[model samples]
Target: MGLVNKTRITDNLAVIIGNQHIDVIATEDFPFDVQIRFIKTDDAQLDDGSGKKVFTPEYQMAFAAAYKGKSAFFSNTEDIKSFTKQLKEIKELFEFATLNKQTWFDTASFDGVLSQKVGSL
Candidate 1:
């Protein structure tokens, strides 16, 4: 339903999830597509027509808050616990490249690894 694992660009202008780059267009006046992706199997920033998905401004704003350390990034204590669980389950994922948003695994493999331990997340 949502971007399960999203990376917040430092500028907060965008958030990338699994090869897709989602820009923040909080208002209708802003002229731009909200979602951009390479392909279902590649994160090279190429154009893909079928990779489209629905976008919601509210959800994007919530994800942008994650870039602000002072923001209530975690809704409650349980949110922290869920994050902690993810850390323990996959420590290697914390190390990510800053050049551009990327996923270490393909959809199926990534989902398989995380879903196996997503009891609380």
Candidate 2:
């Protein structure tokens, strides 16, 4: 599974992960150094037959702006647009980390030769 581009419809943003839809919300202070939260829409189970619903923690991304050698804030439309650009990069990093973790586990028990082969590929 991979992170898909967020679709904007009106005032809300939708991020697709696997078959799930996650909503992104801005913090109370919108036009400033703010944090964005990713909320999962479904309560899916993480364990098989455990009956325990998967608890997806809120994922947040923050951005701070600086101007004239001091801390600046988002004050215009451009600032909000820049924040969205940063959000895209953050999502990519999140997906990369997930993929790396999976690859690490898949090769963790490999023998030395196999490990080297996989590393070189």
TM-score, per-candidate, Cα-based: 0.24, 0.27
* Residue 89's lDDT in candidate 1: 26
Could you say which candidate leads in TM-score?
2
Stretches > 4 Å off in candidate 1: 7-12, 16-26, 40-98, 104-121
Number of backbone-clashing residue pairs for each candidate, in the order shown: 0, 0
The candidate maximizing lDDT is 2
Every candidate's lDDT: 0.31, 0.35
Model 2 lDDT at residue 85: 67
Residue-level lDDT of model 2, residues 23-72, one tens digit each, is 33333433323222222223334655677545432222222222222444
Residue 42 miss distance in model 2 (angstroms): 29
lDDT of 1: 0.31
Model 1 residue 97 CA deviation in Å: 10
Q: Put down candidate 1 lDDT per residue, 12-117, tens digits, no spaces.
A: 1234343323333222322222333222322223335777433311101111112223343678999788556533322222222212222423431232111111
